[model samples]
Target: MLTKEAFNALLKTLEEPPENIKFFFATTEPQKVLPTIISRCQRFELKRISNELIIEKLSAISKDLEREIEKDALYQISNFSEGSLRDAQSLLDQIFCYSDGKITLEYVNNALGFIDPDFFFELDNQISKANTSFAFEFVNKVHSLGKDLSYIIEELIEHFKNLLIIKFNSKTSKFLSETILKKYVLSSALYQEEELFYILETLTQATILHKNYFKKIHLETVMLKIIKSKNVLSLDILVKKVN
Candidate 1:
């Protein structure tokens, strides 16, 4: 960012640039980078690398190095990397060292302290059955495993959001493998649309409020609230507690 006067001077030069002059500006948020500056430039927005591409690249790397890796493991690595090739490579590097020439889901979860989708599936099952005691036991097991409580909350929020998406747009599951898609479809049946939305809202707020000490307790309390609320939750009440 620049002062108005400085930007004006730069604008003047850009409006009538010297021959062969070139300027490059990059940002994650281009909309905030002054509209006047944008009007003078040709824009090219870079799209994120698709999960399919990332997974393919990871698979190639693992095979070329003679390391056995599962397809689901590749997808998980791709998902966590968030479309960053450098990050994906770094994750693969760590995974390679941790794996004994063969990478499995359990190996990845244990090595990285990653909360597996199985955890969410089990939790969802218990919640569907209105088994609050099981949810508590699950949370205790997660805590004992030294998993990141905050991360789990965020992941759970994403999981339910996916369920809501699948609930409304059933065709969206076609993007996922049949196995993963089946899980989401089954999970979606356990909640009404508004119930999932209420949950997503509460968990989001919990992320901000419970970022301090005793996060494990905070996460457990919120999970219990969510699982126990078989009916639609009072949004007002959930917000009040989170706030």
Candidate 2:
């Protein structure tokens, strides 16, 4: 960020620039820049690079390097990189150095400290089945692996969000990988849409509280609340049950 004095100087330069000089400015937060400075320059918004394109580029890079990487691993890399191809390429370089043989999804997770999708799926299964023992066991496993509980809570929020999307509109599931899509298809059938929303709300609250003070026990408490939560039934369904 430029100081106010620097911005004033830049504004003056923009007003009367040297001959044959072109000024180009790029920023992710244009609103923070002085309005006068912005008025003197044209602005262009760049869209985030699509995950498919990122994956395609990563694949090309891997092939050129004569390194074998799994499609799912590439997908994970693309997601972690958000929309920056530079970050994606850098991550790929790091992973390439981390592994000697063909890179697998597990390898990517380990190298990046990312929780495996299987952990989410398994936790969801245990929660749906009300398997209290396995749910706690899952938490213990995550703790043993030194995973951040706050991050796990955030991921759980997204995991349930995906399930809700699958239940509401399977068509949009195209954003998910085939393996995860198949798992979501089966899992979505286990809960009503309302239940998924309830879980999202609960996890969101936990996330807020986690910022203040967090502990493994708090996570366990949240999981127990989720596991024992009553199914939210619509009035129509309630009336049907009454008859």
Candidate 3:
């Protein structure tokens, strides 16, 4: 970022640079750059690389290094990298040094301190069963592990969102693996579409409130609310009850 005076001083140099001189500027936020400066330079926009491409690159690197890594591990690295090739490569380097043998998804989760997806699935199951004791104990265990409560909430939101997608249209879930897809298929059966919507809504609201007053109790309270949420009946179910 340049100050107004700095832009003014650079304006002349941009307009008429020395014969062999050229100027190049890069910014993630081009709109923040002065229009006068932008007008004087040719702009290029770069889009984020796709996860498949990132995994392909990582696979090539792993082969070149003579290191064995699971395909699922590579996918996890790509996802955590969030479309940043440099970060993905750096993370791969670190993980490679961390492991003495073949890298697996468990190694990746341990290195990243990410909660296993199974935990979310089990938590959902407990909530569906309205097992408050299990829910509270699970929260305490995760808290004891020093995991961020807010991050857990975010993952829960995404977990239920995936469930909602699976319930609504399983065909659109090509991103998930066959094993995980089977689990989702089973989990989606536990909630109606309307019930999933209500859960998502509640989770979103909890996220907002958690941001304002962050506390473990807030998380536990939200979990209790979710576990005890009233079941929402679909139109067909309602009509059947009336009949």
Candidate 3, pairs of clashing residues: none
Q: 1 or 2: which has the higher TM-score? A: 2
How would you encode candidate 3's per-residue C-alpha lDDT over 1-243 as one tens digit per residue? 888899889998888898997777877778878889888888898888887789999999999999999887887898789888999999999999978899988889789888887887787788688787776887797889898787777878878899999998998875565677788888888887777787888888887644656567888887877776545465867897899
* TM-score of candidate 2 relative to the true fold: 0.91
Off by over 4 Å in 3: 1-10, 209-214, 230-243
Ranking by lDDT: 2, 3, 1
lDDT of 1 by residue, 112-139 (tens): 6777787888887887787878757877
Which parts of model 2 have CA positions greater than 4 angstroms off? 230-240
For all candidates in order, the CA lDDT equals 0.79, 0.83, 0.82
83 Cα displacement, candidate 1 (Å):
1.8
Looking at model 1, report the run of 10 residues with the lowest lDDT sum: 172-181
Quick one: best lDDT, which candidate? 2
**lDDT for model 1, on a 0 to 1 scale?**
0.79
lDDT of candidate model 3 versus the reference: 0.82
